[model samples]
Target: MGTADGDGLREFYSAQQPRLVGVVSLLTGSRAEAEDIVQEAFVRLVPRWGKVSRYDAPEAWVRLVAVRLAANRHRDRSRLTGLFHRLPREQAAPDPAEAYGGDLEQALAGLPMPTRQVVVLYYVCDLSVAQVADTLGIAEGTVKSRLARGREALGAALRSDDHA
Candidate 1:
């Protein structure tokens, strides 16, 4: 790529990286994992920057990649869990509620990954249902259903927390 192309990619990365990390973190429920996922997405984007930069919303490409990576990682982790015994680590991890430090974040974390992805992409990213469906490669109807379920679940969780 030319110097101008490199400069444009750098500027895009600077502007979009933090926001993408936040979106991925909400999707993955771990800031550390989100960082890694987002970074890898950008790495993958490097070669495609020439083409992707011309797109109306290049960030969407990166976000889609990061989301898919997070989903793949979750699936791999689940499969590995079936094959191996998990050993207790020496370090005690912080409670997710405390780590996230917000009732909404805790509630989102409680959601099933699929529901959480739809909720985060639609609400947090402010993407339209069609956009979300496109990003996730699902039907718009599926996105709508997931959003409905997510809203109900989040509402109940927040209500219960309020009562406690």
Candidate 2:
């Protein structure tokens, strides 16, 4: 990357890190993991900044990288869980009940991965449909469908919780 690219990337990093972390945390359900993912994304982005900075939205690229990394990590954990089944699992640290609130958090947690990603990227991260499509490398129609279904699922989940 050129000196100009480095300077631009530094400015972008300062502006976008907190927002990126927020989006990743919403997806991964762990703030610490989210921060790590965003940081790693930034690191990966730096070397490619010359190319990526020319994009219409470089922040979108960073977000896509972080989200993809988080998804890969999730898959790796699932695979490892099967291989390590015989090993005792460590207890996770407790989360504060109010850290992410109640019904909405529960609703989001209940969503399937694709829909959850769509919802978080579209709604929480405030990305446009086209932007989300580009970020996920999916069709715009797919993003719309996921967002629609995700909203339906969230509404149902919340309603069920209310009834209970």
Candidate 3:
């Protein structure tokens, strides 16, 4: 890449990295993994920067890649655990939820990944239902249903926590 391209990427990285990390952290429930995933996504973007930087929302591309990577990691980890019955390693990254506060993060942690993905993209990223559906490659109806379920689950969890 040219110096101009490199400078543009540095600028883009400075602008988008932290937000991407936060969003991915919510998705994977591990700030450390999110950092790695986001970094990988940006690294992937380096080769494609010529075309991607021209896109209206290049960050969307990076976010999509990061989310998919997180999902893949989750799946791979699940399969390994099922096969070996091993405990998960402790992550050194600070809890992403701690930034938002404990209760909501804990409630979000209880959600299935799909529902949590829908919830975070819709609420935290402020994406439209159509946008969220497109991002996750699910139908709009599926996104709506997942959002509904997420809302109900989070509400119940938060209320119970309040009472306790």
Candidate 4:
């Protein structure tokens, strides 16, 4: 890659690192593993800078890649659980503040995959319904429906937490 391409990649990674880490962290509870996933996502992007550059939504691609990799990490952990004698640290979820703090974050993490994906893209990332639809390769109406359902679920979860 030329210096210009290298700079562009650096800029892309720099701008996206925190959001990618946050997404991965939600999927995989380990802050450490989340960082690793973000690194690997960027590594996956390096070779395809040409294609990525042409992509109308490179961030969407990165988000999807991170989600898939996180899912794979979960699957790999489950598969190796029987093979390993020791318990995995990633399997041990972090402690959250039971009273007030981290409640919303915990709730979001507990949601089903589709709801979580829609919620994260629409609420957390502030992506529009159409943008999310494009990212997930779904219809705009589907995005709207999912967004409504996710919002309702999240709202209920939050309300319950509040009343607790």
Candidate 5:
């Protein structure tokens, strides 16, 4: 790419990286893993920057790629778990919520992957249903359904936490 294209890509990365990482972290339930996934998404985007920069919403593309990567990682983990049953597992560190004393974060972490993606994309990323549908390559109705179910699950999780 030319210097101008490189500069544009840099600017885009600077503007979008934090939000993308936040979205991915919520989806993956691991801030460190989210950062890695988002970085890889940007790396993939760099080669297509010339075309991506012209999109009406390039951030949507980045979000889509990150979500897919997280899904793939989950699938790979599942497969590996089945294959390596004898291997001792390394424990993940304490939840990131411990740092902020945020029950909502923990509640969100409990959501199913598809529901969580819809919630994060709609509420956290502030995308519309159509945008999220496009990002996830699902029907708009599917996005709405996930959003409704996700909201109900999150509400129940938070309420239970409060009573506890």
Candidate 6:
């Protein structure tokens, strides 16, 4: 990267690292793991920092990278230890109980991966339907369907949890 690009990335990292670490930590359920994920993400992003800076949300790019790294880290742990980072994700989702039991995250975790990805991309990432479709290499219709199904499943899961 050029000197200008390097400076830009440094500035971006300085601005975003705290939020990135907090989100990564919440997602990974480990502060140390969060730090590792953030580092890995910044490393992966360094070479492409210029490209990333052109995006409307450079922080989003970093966040996506960090989350992916955390996922990969969990996958590696599973291979080495026969289990890793498999915490019931929904349960780990920040408490609605503590934050006001809105939608149960545990139920959302039960959805199929594609559906979950679409939902998070749209809802959490605030990406447009087209953006999500492009990111997942699927049609917009597919993105919509997955999102709908995911919402339905999450709703059902939360209801079931309540009844139980």
Candidate number with greatest lDDT:
1
Q: How do these models rank on lDDT, best leading?
A: 1, 3, 5, 2, 4, 6
* lDDT for each residue of candidate 2 in 1-164, tens digit (9 for 90 to 100): 67877789889999999988988887777789999999999999988898898998888788889989988887786676556655555644333333433467667866766788889999988889998888898999999999999999888877866776
lDDT of 1 by residue, 49-139 (tens): 9999999999999999999999899789667754544445444443444543337877888787889999999999999999999999999
If scored against the real structure, what TM-score would every candidate get?
0.86, 0.80, 0.87, 0.73, 0.84, 0.63
Residue 122 error for model 3, in Å? 0.4
Candidates 4 and 6: which is better by TM-score?
Answer: 4
Q: Which stretches of candidate 5 lie over 4 Å from their true place?
A: 81-102
- Candidate 6: lDDT of 36? 85
Q: Against the correct fold, how does model 2 do in TM-score?
A: 0.80
Model 6 agreement with the true structure over 43-147: per-residue lDDT tens digits: 989888878899987777787777667667756754754332355656444433243343444454455556766776687667899987876678999998898
Question: What is the Å distance of residue 99 in model 2 from its true position?
Answer: 14
lDDT of 5 at 41: 97
Error of 1 at 40 (Å): 0.2
Ranking according to TM-score, highest score first: 3, 1, 5, 2, 4, 6
Tally clashes: model 2: 0
Q: How many Å off is the CA of 134 in candidate 3?
A: 0.9
* All models, RMSD in angstroms: 3.5, 3.9, 4.8, 4.8, 3.9, 6.7
Best candidate (score: TM-score): 3
Q: Write the per-residue lDDT of candidate 5 for residues 1-164, one digit (tens) a residue.
A: 99999999999999999988988888887899999999999999999999999998888788889999998897786576566655555544343445433366667777777788889989988989998898888999999999999999888877766776
Clashes (N, CA, C under 3 Å) per candidate: 0, 0, 0, 0, 0, 4
lDDT of each: 0.88, 0.82, 0.87, 0.76, 0.84, 0.71
lDDT of 5: 0.84
Off by over 4 Å in 4: 27-30, 74-102
lDDT of 1 at 136: 96
RMSD of 4: 4.8
